[model samples]
Target: MSDRPDDTPAPRDADELNEAVSDLGETDTDRLEAVRGRNESLEERLPGDEQLPRTHGSPEKG
Candidate 1:
């Protein structure tokens, strides 16, 4: 007389876990693109969007 429903989604099996790990292995490009985009936007907001002023004689023997 058990009335428990069994429509719940099945837990991820070994194959699914392996595939998930494989997918994570190939997501570097997307991550890099997002970081580059954020960096450009932040540079635009700063006072000097081009480059910081170079220090004079800070590092000799160049």
Candidate 2:
């Protein structure tokens, strides 16, 4: 494991790559409709597509 050299792959990135593609992506509902305008619901107790009722272990003992 000393003077070894067999990796191969010297194909330069065709000039820093950028063939052509620009749409100024933003996604995520355009960043929550441009920050603070909405999109913060984390469902603390209910609301936000509620759905919780699985308990199949051992925690309902009181």
> What TM-score fits each model?
0.36, 0.17
Error of 1 at 52 (Å): 10
**lDDT per residue (tens digit) for residues 1-62 in model 1:** 54656886677999897675564345767656766888899977887733666566465555
lDDT of 2 by residue, 7-39 (tens): 854545754332321122246465545443333
Q: After superposition, how far is residue 24 of candidate 2 from its true place, in Å?
A: 20
Error of 1 at 44 (Å): 0.4
Worst 10 residues of 1 by lDDT: 49-58
In model 2, the runs with Cα more than 4 Å from the true position are: 1-37, 42-54
TM-score, candidate 1, is 0.36
Candidate 2 has its poorest 10 consecutive residues by lDDT at: 16-25
Model 1 spans > 4 angstroms off: 1-26, 49-62
Clashing pairs in 1: none
lDDT of 1 at 20: 59
TM-score of 2: 0.17
